[model samples]
Target: MSHRQVMKVLSGLLLGMFVAILSSTVVSTALPRIVADLGGGQSAYTWVVTASLLSMTASTPLWGKLADLAGKKVLVQSAIVIFVLASAGAGLAQSTGVLIAFRAVQGIGVGGLVALAQVILASIVPPRERGRYSGYFGATFAVATVGGPLLGGVITDTPGLGWRWCFYVGVPFAVIALAVLQRTLRLPAARRPDVRVDWLGALLVAASVCLLLVWVTLAGDSYAWASWQTAAMVGGSVLLGLLFVRVEARAADPVMPLWLFRNRTIALSALASLFVGVAMFGSTVFLSQYFQLARGESPTTAGVMTIPMIAGLFASSTVSGLVITRTGRWKAWLVAGGTLVTAGLGLLGTMRYDTAYWQLAVYMGLLGTGIGMMMQNLVLATQNQVSAEQLGAASSSVTFFRSLGGAVGVSALGAALSGRVSHYVEEGMAAAGIPQSGAAGGGAIPDLGSLPGPVRQVIESSYGHGIADVHLYAAPLALVALLLVLAVREVPLGRRAVGE
Candidate 1:
């Protein structure tokens, strides 16, 4: 394909990608308001985010397998339709239950989009020249990641417009992406007739993940972690996972092929992504709450505060991509990124509600820079190690694990934060000689603007210290990721002819 042709296809691909990324992050700022309006506790707040991630993680491998057998254009269009309908449904939801259901449906489509965009790109662009295009993709992602939160905040804060518009806003973007793909995307080959899907493997994978997430999300809040409920869920999940391994080993077309792990690059990248998932998604998802509940910032102001992180992401991804293209070196960037992530998370762990804004900005910048350098390069590195035949499976496997890590990290960290806040609130109440009955229950998520002055201080301080505690827990995970990155052997850049 010529440069102009690549741009035409990229225009649609980028827009579709923006929708996926935007849908996930936009809700972060609006979540507190959503939970308050819908009347849920802290666990519900985490489940809203975790539900989407769970569905996305569970479906990614199936979507990747489908992409290989199904026509890419048709699959892409189907995903867009699914996403648009789900988004509309989510916007219309009157209850947390309904919203979570819609978000899960929306995640099915997101899984497809996330896996397909890169798989298709790998098909069209040779790995050597892919750096330039990948940079464009990375920049588009950075913009969406930053823009979604602000946009969601603005929409939610706008009187009479409300938080529902955050869900509705993706409709127009989805429509545009569908039209662009219809007009511009061209496939290289016809769909094969002999392809078969490993339905049992898909089922097993979903069952295991769902069971485990159920335990992870509900154990501490709904029941004791050491009870029969935990035994049932954890044991059931392990058995299902084992069955999935057995099924995949024998299936003609495994949704998640077990053999892919035999490749060193794939194994390393997937492991690194798993740890990065815990570090990146676990810590950052709470920033909106930090600004609002801790610092007492409005929704829009909280959105704006995230710009420092975005700036670092944009600068590092753009600069590192261009440099890698010129020098044909990427491993050094990965190592530096892992190191930065560990350092950044470690620094962020010490912050509390009263921590200065400038210090927060610096810490976020370092973390963002680390993510920018690492995320895409890992995928790029994995792609370089395989033949084109394995691209879909290989790429999607990495993504699936990363999403898994995110789902687990979010659920676990949210629970941890909630527990810490409850403890702190109890301590504060004791020191101030306030009756225990007057203190808000630990699970309560209240509107900051409506609280009495003294009560608000207690809530904010609890949140501040609690969120920081989660960061402290996550820093070592980032260090684990850094260690994994050091183990990844550098593979040579692809010298395959461009536009093959």
Candidate 2:
């Protein structure tokens, strides 16, 4: 394909990517309001986010395997249709349970987009030239990450629109992407005469991930972390995971090929992606709450305040991609990005509700820059190592682990946040000689406007301290990602396609 042709197809692909990302991020700013409206507490808030991640994580590898067997274009279009339908359902949901169910279905489509986008790109673009195109992906991600919250915040704050519009806003963009993709995408068909999907492996993988995520989300709040329930859930998850590995090893067409892990670059990149997910998704998901709950900012104002982080992500991703394309070297950027992520998380750990906005901006910028440099490049590095035949499996495998990390991280961090906040609020109330039955009691998220000044201050401080602790816990994971990246061998990117 000519450069013009590639760009033409990429327009549709990036738009699809944009829609997928937008759907997830658009709800971040409005989640507080949505949960409160539905009469849910912290666990419900965490589950709302985790439901999608859990489903996306579980389905990613299956989508990738299917892409390798089926044609990419049809699969991409199918995913868009599923996403749009689910988004509509999510918008009309009257309860958190209904919304979560729709979000889970929406994740099945996201799994396709997230895996197939890179797989399709790898099919057309040579690794040496892929960096330039990846910059476009980074830009789309930045825009969606920036715009989703801002748009959601506006929609939520708007009197008539409410939080439901956050789900609806992405539908039109998706419809346009579907039309453009049909017109522009021209890929060689991928059909195997004896294609056999390992359905058992897929099921086992999904069951295992679901069990683990449920355990993590419910462990501290619903039951003691060391109780028999924990043992049962963890044991069940491990058994299912082992069964999945066994099933994959013997399956005709494994959803995730275990042999791929033998490749050094793919293994290290996958591992790095795992830790990156923990730090990136775990910490960033809560920033909206931090602004609204801790700092007492309105939703729209909170969204606007996140611009520095997005700006830094945009700059680093664009610049690093250009440099990598020119030089055909990517290891330095990975190392630098890892360093910055660790530093950023560490710095952010010191922040409280009363911390200066400038300090918060600086810290956020560093974290975003690091993520931008690392995220797509990890896939780029992994894709560079595999042949076209294995592109889907290898690409989605890394994404699966990353998403798995994110699900676990969010669940664990959220649980910790809930417990810490409750503890802090209790101490503050006691110190102030306030009753335990105040608005902040019962572990429910409080309405700041409804509380007295002293009580509100206590709630704010609790959230600030608890959130900071989450960042502190995540910093070590970023450091682990840095080590993994450093260990990755730098291979010179070739101009020719894989297996050429």
Candidate 3:
């Protein structure tokens, strides 16, 4: 295929990417309203993010391995259909639990889309020009990041329609993407007479993650972190994880090939992705809460306030992709990105409920720019190091680890935030001479507007500080990625692009 033909195929892939990314961010600003309407607290808010990431993380490797054994086109189209149906189901959810269940289902499709889009591209494009194409992917991501929040905010704030519309809105784009892909994508058949999937490995990994998440989400709030529940969950997770390693090492077709980690680049990239996930997902999930609960902004205003971050993401990804493609000197950008991300998160740590809007914007801009530079580039770097046959596994490996990091980050940070807010609210009640026993109905997540002046102030101040503190925890982890990037060896990219 010529360059024009390649671009034609990419059109459908880009649309699929757009719909997938759109589903995630659209819920960010709408989350508080969803929780309020569905009747839950911070745990529900955290689960909304965690459930998706958890499912995505667990399924990513399966999708990648399957793509290698089965065929890319059929797998990609199936993912699109699953996403569309899950979106419709999510739109009809009447309770937080049901919504969460649907979101988990949605995540399986999202995991497939995220991994396969990259796998398909890697199969078609040469390493040298991947940065350029990846830049387009990054641009698509930024567009979805920008639009999802803005559109979701608008829908949530509308007169009659609510946050449910955010889920419904992406269906048409996904359907069109499915239609376009069926016509344009041409790939050789991928089947092996002796092919086998490592189902035991997948089930063990999912079980371990589920048990661990249950522990992270419930530890402080529902029971003591040092109790028998912790012993059971933690011990079980460790056993299951080790069991998974054993299974992968012996399986004829492992979900995660153990040899891939023998490559220094893959090993370090996976490590960086893990830290990035913990820091990135854990810290950023609460920004809407900061704006709405702490600053008393509406969903629409909160969405608008986040524009600086998305703008930085767009600028950095677009520019870096072009630069890497032109010069083939990609290591500096990775180092620069890690530094900016660490610096950004560190700066954001100083913010509180009363921090000025301009200061917050600057900090968020730095974080987003750093992420844009680092995110796709790491996968590109890894893809450059692997054989053509290992492309899907290699691509999906990076994605799976990143999602893993996100799941842990959201759960651990959610625990930390919940604990911190409860303490602050308790102290505030005591200081204001309010009765401790019945304070705000035992610390239910209050509708800030519905509370009395003194009570509202206390809740706002608590959330403001709690949200800020989690960033401080995450900043050090991002710095760890910076150190890893500094040590990564840069490889020259191929000048000519290829296709299947």
Candidate 4:
């Protein structure tokens, strides 16, 4: 390809990626209002996010496989088209179910966008130069991470253009990405002879993941942890998981190669990605809610408060990527990132309704820096370890686990918050000489504006306490992640494309 053509393809890839990330991140700040407007409860809110994560996680390998079979350009454009349709459908949905179903569709598109972007980038950039461009990907990740909440908050708070616009807003950008890619992006095709998709493997993997997600989502809420529902979900998940392992081993082209797990580097990276996903996605998804409910910030203001986190992420990720490229050291950053994430979560666990804003900012910054250092480097380290042909499988596999971890964490944490909030609300109301009956409503906590000032303060305080507990509860998981990072052997950085 000509230099101009290469640049055009790269630009289109980045733009498509930005829109994909933007759609996911931007919904964070707007979720509370969106759920309320759609007449749903906390579980609905959790599902809204989980459904997307589930679809995204499950579809990633499929997209990668498709890219290997079909042409990259065709798959990427098709993903964008599907994403546009889903976004419009989600924006126009009248009910939570419709919104969730469409969001799932959108997630599938996001899966394609994410996986194929890496694939195409690898086709153009060499391993050494890839880091410099990986910096761009990191920046794009940070921007979308920051912009999603900020934009979501603004759209949610704005009159006559509420949370729905957050979904609608991406439609035009995705359309543009599709048109640009169609016109400008060209690449060598992966026309492997006798290529066939492993559809059964895909179905088994999806079923297994869905069962597991549902189990996590339902545990400690719809049933006791030891109840029949739990047993069924947990049992069914285990069975399907084993079945998937068997299927992958036997399939000519498995969605996930069972052999990939044998590589220590790939295994470690996947584990690290899982923890990072839990810490990064699980924590950030709830920040907007905490800021609005606990700190009493407006949605827009909540988005603004997150600047320290985004800034920390961008700075650390860029700096670390550069230093790793120069020095060929990566494992230390993984260990450090995990440690920082642990510390950040612990700091956040100390938060209260009246906690100083500066303190929160500091905690957020620490968390962001840790995540920045760890997330992409995990992929980088894995890429360095695997062969070129294994690139698609390895990359998609890491992404798949990371996303699955996020979905699991969100469901578990969301359920915890729901229960904790109920307990605190009850305690606060009783302490204030109000009837316990006042806290009996089974949906989302009512809007603070609707309550009397004193009652509202109590509600806010309860939410703050509950959110702090959520962080505290999740801290051990981050610490465990930190320990896992420590176990990863330091691997020298190589001149290998991530999707090698």
- All models, RMSD in angstroms: 1.4, 1.0, 1.6, 2.0
Candidate 2: pairs in clash: none
What residue runs in model 3 are displaced by over 4 Å at the alpha carbon?
436-443, 496-500
**Residue 51 of candidate 3: its Cα lDDT?**
90
lDDT of 1 by residue, 93-113 (tens): 999899989989998999899
Candidate 4 lDDT, tens digit per residue, 1-500?
A: 44365666788788888898898888888887788788888888888988888999999988877776778898998888888889889989899999999999999998888788766666666555555556667888999889989998889888999888898888888878878888888776777778688898889889988988888777777788888988888899889889988988998988888898888878878887887788887788777778887767888888889989999898888888788767778888888998999899999999988999999999999999998888877777776666666667777888888888888888888888888888888888878887765553324745766777767777788878887887887778888878777877776766644444
Best by lDDT: 2
The lDDT, on a scale of 0 to 1, for candidate 2 is 0.91
Model 2 ranges off by over 4 Å:
none
Cα lDDT listed for each candidate: 0.85, 0.91, 0.86, 0.82
Superposed on all Cα atoms, model 4 deviates from the true structure by an RMSD in Å of: 2.0
Which digits, one per residue and each the tens of the lDDT, describe model 2 over residues 270-311?
A: 999999988778876888889999999888999999898899
lDDT of 1: 0.85
TM value for model 3: 0.97
Q: How much lDDT does candidate 3 score?
A: 0.86
Give the count of colliding residue pairs in each prediction: 0, 0, 0, 2
Kindly give the stretch of ten consecutive residues in candidate 4 with the minimal lDDT sum: 437-446
Model 1, C-alpha of 123: deviation from truth (Å): 0.6
